[model samples]
Target chain A: MTRLDMFIDRMVSQRACLDFAIAETALMGGPVFELGLGNGRTYDHLRDRVTGRPIYVFERAVASNPASTPPEDMTILGDVRETLPQAVGRFGDTASLIHADLGGHNLAKNDEFARLVSPLIAPLLAPGGLMVSSDRMYFDALEQVPLPTGAVEGRCFIYRRPTA
Target chain B: MTRLDMFIDRMVSQRACLDFAIAETALMGGPVFELGLGNGRTYDHLRDRVTGRPIYVFERAVASNPASTPPEDMTILGDVRETLPQAVGRFGDTASLIHADLGGHNLAKNDEFARLVSPLIAPLLAPGGLMVSSDRMYFDALEQVPLPTGAVEGRCFIYRRPTA
Candidate 1:
């Protein structure tokens, strides 16, 4: 088993949802770009299953935290907002899937971030490509909890660039 | 164009997502069920695309709203919470896909709904069968809105029931 498989075996949060996305993307069949690269957990889940296709990950903190990255995958260390331009230029028209799971804190700024990131990411997505990002959303349990900070919830949104 | 294609052209919400699920389910090929069949939009979308496959829909309000249902599909007009058992009794072992978009005022009740719905849906899901549901969760635009009400959000969730 690969490292990602092992990590997945122990993972506890929204595994079903994450796995579904991976399966769907693989079924679609194209180059994939992952944003946020959290501990490379999702990467480990996808690397082996996605064969022959190039998978590029833009991780802002990977350089400062090499331990978080896997030794085998094609992960780059840089801010996605800044590095995406050059990366897309290098890949030409091959990139097709852009997957982001940057957490609720990052998602809080999604609109502003999307403005900067979408233009760069949109161009990189090949015709029929998908851009998926995670956001936190209010669930009842969270609402019931009496927190020091008020609840802020969201969910993932997937946008597809028309193939025609 | 097929009957399903014609039906899809008229749907207003969740059209792309519903189309994707239906196409995926048809391509996967097996018995399928749809829970909370609001307006029967999805049923209409899949009817002709999946020829000869048994497609069941459980809807609490369908009996009252006959216009919502398509003539060719099999539909059970009853609450999913109450009728799932009987539905499962008839077709438990062969079901391969479960499509649900059960949310509006139902957001706060997801855990209860998921729990009750999972068992009935679980047994019916063929090995490797996918259970697809669209969930509503708050995001950036709704961050400032009141907790109980806001724009109805939608997110898709899929679960691949384990064969073993």
Candidate 2:
């Protein structure tokens, strides 16, 4: 495989996991959350797949393809440090699905961000809801679930809030 | 991306797809079929994930890792052209899940084989069941499905038998 093949695998896997999550959580009544709306490709995909639910996008600055941009009402314009906590207060544990693709080229930096953000993201999920991320997250409450078919093992991670 | 990375992606994607298919079709009642059980790695994985269902392996020869080989009662020995027809006679449209990873390194040969074997494999699936393959298959009766996450596009394919 070349660099192009690797990239294709990542992209295909991401879409596959997200699609599976959308279908699995279809019956659950709650909003969806998208962290890091870079280029808004995944967000656009989500809008196409998910119905009858709000998809809240968190972004510090809105810079994405014009056609893929989320509506103002649905986009939360702020750093996640402030926005995620506030989201918990407003939405409670009601998000049926949350997707994050926040990793950068720096592995250490990405890991640090994953650690800082994992706790903030955990409480937003409904019991039995899923958290899909491109990086590993440390969540004491959420248990990691097996990746859906077509998803690369380390390329994407899925964690579920147990329905206890 | 290197060749090793590509191989890893293929293996992981294969497992992810198989696991997803297994979980999705768990409620359906029928046997599982493994076509071309080379080395029986996938056969072993299937045995581990699927329970209370007979896993029939179709092979031209019996050589495999001793620990991974299917029992004599479940192994169908012969060319697929002969055995697949026999399978249709014996099992009909009652396979809950059918997995085929029969492709080799030769693209042209794999494509030819896929074309030849596809119709033979199509009639084995139960209504609403899934077929996970390592190569693109031509199925007139089965509809191609979206691949699950972690599965690289073109690295694997999934098809479903629609319930009438």
Real interface contacts reproduced by model 2, as a fraction = 0.00
Task: Give Cα-based local distance difference scores for all models.
Answer: 0.54, 0.87
Error of 2 at A150 (Å): 1.0
What is the Cα-based lDDT of residue A149 in candidate 2? 91
Looking only at chain B, model 1 earns a TM-score of 0.66
Of the true interface contacts, each candidate retains a share of 0.00, 0.00
Best by the lDDT measure: 2
**Ten-residue stretch with the least lDDT total in model 1 chain B:** B142-151
Candidate 2 residue lDDT tens string, A12-57: 6788788899998999989999999987778888888899989999
lDDT of 1 by residue, A23-62 (tens): 5555565678877776555565555455666777788777
Any runs in candidate 1 off by more than 4 Å, and if so which?
A: A1-164, B1-14, B27-29, B63-68, B136-154
lDDT of 2 at B35: 91
The 10 consecutive residues of candidate 2 chain B with the worst lDDT sum are B1-10
Model 1: fraction of the reference interface contacts it also forms: 0.00
